[model samples]
Target: MAADLYPSSPAPSAASQTRFQKLRKRLHKDRALLLLALPGILYFLIYKYLPMFGLVIAFNDYSPFQGFFGSEWVGLGQFRKIFSDTEVLRVIWNTLFISFLQIVFAFPIPIVLALMLNAVRNQLYKRIIQTVVYLPHFLSWVVVIGICVLFLKSEGLINEILKSIGLPAIPFLTDPAYFKPLIVGQVIWKETGWGTIIFLAALAGVNPNLYEAAVMDGANRWRQTWHITLPSIRSTIIILLILRLGSVLDSGFEQIWLMLNPFNKDTGNVLDTFVYFKGIEQSDYSFATAVGLFKGVVGLILVMGANYLAKRFGEEGVY
Candidate 1:
């Protein structure tokens, strides 16, 4: 009578059933963590991933009047423009040179700052310094450039002080020679402290006993830093360097744009500025998007190559 009252449902396939159960259990276990991450995941999906669909316009002779799908398909014609343009090669060269400067100069500032901060024995002073250094990062590029202009301009504070000492007021802003250096300097100032956060966090995880052992072996502070401290953070540094190479194209668009003028355009006109002039100013969206797409592809390749090299060198890269 009981058997007749109910029929058994068919069992799901063993592999699929097991996988589902495991996934469900894992989700349940990490429910709170997933919940916390939900907002960020949603944000990226909405803003970053969804908008990637618009990249299709890069393949077209896109016009506002024609709309997205209605735009004429130009194939690689837009990208062809990027390679054929003589001025673009100069802009590319400028971009590459600036990126090289940033990597060579700006990339190390954070690591150095982290080392300095890590060495500081006084917690109070370290906190104060950290707070001070981090303040600039919160300021927008406009604000930072405004502040820089206030100090670096002809009649600005620095020139005034220089003039007071019988030195000539140098054209730091106007001179093409100074433009690249100034851009790199501004990046170092703004991002050095913020970048140190990752290194500092890594440093905190290092074993304290290593320092004690180094001390027992008569290792001085410099020796300890070079031998123990730097070695311990070697992976962290390498990982960061690899990641830096990935986005080397993004050499502060807003700051450079703000600083650029007719006087410094010869040296200052980078790919970013070129894209802006073509896309926004000249309303050649397809051309601008093609240039941007090239940049993105190059960045992706750099990231992959760097990651492969990192793994070959036995350091965990940003996989």
Candidate 2:
């Protein structure tokens, strides 16, 4: 019995040593690629992970003079303030409404545009259209907002056209009722073409034989797209949808902040702008940090839930 027990010990150690050696060899083989990725790894470690240490400020009465370590802990005091504040609630509602609208309406635009462009037989015309549409995405938000102001202001070109056409001047940008639509429309117009690039790539990956086979079976172009093309790109669609779901809380800051006036604040103020106002403008560091932490947690939960659903449905999700 003693001899048999002693004999098993060396065998286990030898197997462990072999496994370690194999792992070492594999790492050595991929050393160059690992080196190439080191900078990005360090960047996330320093910038992203390191900042998480400051999240403790959310529970403290953080003051520049006191410093993070010297700040007095208040527990959930800041979160309580956020919950009781009606303005913050309004901001949250506005953010959710705009984000929901964008996800619902803006998300499908690129896919539709890609399908339409793919159907076009003329390569030159398709490229021209794509170039024109994609150019807007490269324009700075400031420039885009300036362009919008020129066209949508009370006395601007759109109102002028409406006046000329014997219709009343509609407030496109200034009115509270129109703010959500305007923001959604701007996002769709600016990003749709750039977004289509991925879908187009996915469409290209679709085997031509599938379409040919469908055509031979008396399937029309629309029918072929419905059956073959859409199915081929389903994975890409699900992945993008998961990403969009993750950002369902962030309605952007630059465009809304630049465009919103007192008149449009009800529908224009979002979580980002609210955080800015509370943190930088009012110097309420603790409250702002708490709100931001809340948003981040919600975003993480959304992404995780979406990814889980994607996996459950047998789709390739963001890991």
Candidate 3:
């Protein structure tokens, strides 16, 4: 009975041998292209995938003095501490609030801008307007924050104008109420033009014949846009949205960190900033790692969920 239970492995069929040979021949034919791709593959393997091994530190009471392997294993202790801490909960809420605002308010602006640009009658004006909007994207966050401070400060231009009008100066920087709006505004101003690039490309690929057909059928401008333009770029929008959801937890670390102050900390504090304070500033490596790991898990879940919804709606999604 025991002997009967042990089965012999099947030999490779002639068809399988041919298939393997075909694959080998194809690889050899594309060797040059494969060589060109090697650097990118190696970059991800070295810089991205290789560092994932350090995630184990989240489960350990890691100490730089003891090093990675020498650190004491604490299992879920770090995660437990994260959940039990009230401050961490508040930080998580702030992170989610800011992220939600960005996704809702900032995400659609680029699409609208692209549609408007596509409808422009003159190429010269379109190019000039595109240049003006795209210029802000190249500016560093430090420069942007500096400009904001220069204009939005109590004694600055905005307040000075308000003062001239016998109006009170609004607290743009220090108030918690204004923090989320400021962050969203900065993101929109800096990225909206750059974000429109993909949508514009998608729009360009849309057949002009479709518009002509629609016009012949007595369709109006808005109807043509709704029926032809939006549907053509729907797949591109879905793919980008899925990609966006994958990084939902990453709420602009440099920008938020630069803008964050003690007075606005309640609204400005997020997982990235919290991790910086705990991991780099306070040197609580394991605890901070746990928080980062949690954020990554949540982001992964969001991406998967968004992709699933997109597919359910019969749309092409990022796979």
TM per prediction: 0.82, 0.85, 0.83
Q: lDDT tens string, model 2, 172-222?
A: 776689888888888998899999999999999999998889999999988
Candidate lDDT (C-alpha), each: 0.88, 0.88, 0.89
Tell me which residue pairs clash in candidate 3: none
Better of 2 and 3 by lDDT: 3
Instruction: Name the runs in model 1 displaced over 4 angstroms.
Output: 1-50
RMSD of 1: 8.0
Cα deviation at 148, candidate 2, in Å, is 0.5
Worst 10 residues of 2 by lDDT: 1-10
Candidate 3 deviates by what RMSD? 7.3
Instruction: State in Å the error of residue 76, model 1.
Output: 1.4
**Which candidate comes out best when scored by TM-score?**
2
Models ranked on TM-score: 2, 3, 1
For all predictions, the C-alpha RMSD in Å is: 8.0, 8.3, 7.3
Global local distance difference test of model 1? 0.88
The model with the greater TM-score, 1 or 3, is 3
Error of 3 at 90 (Å): 1.4
1 or 2, which is superior by lDDT? 1
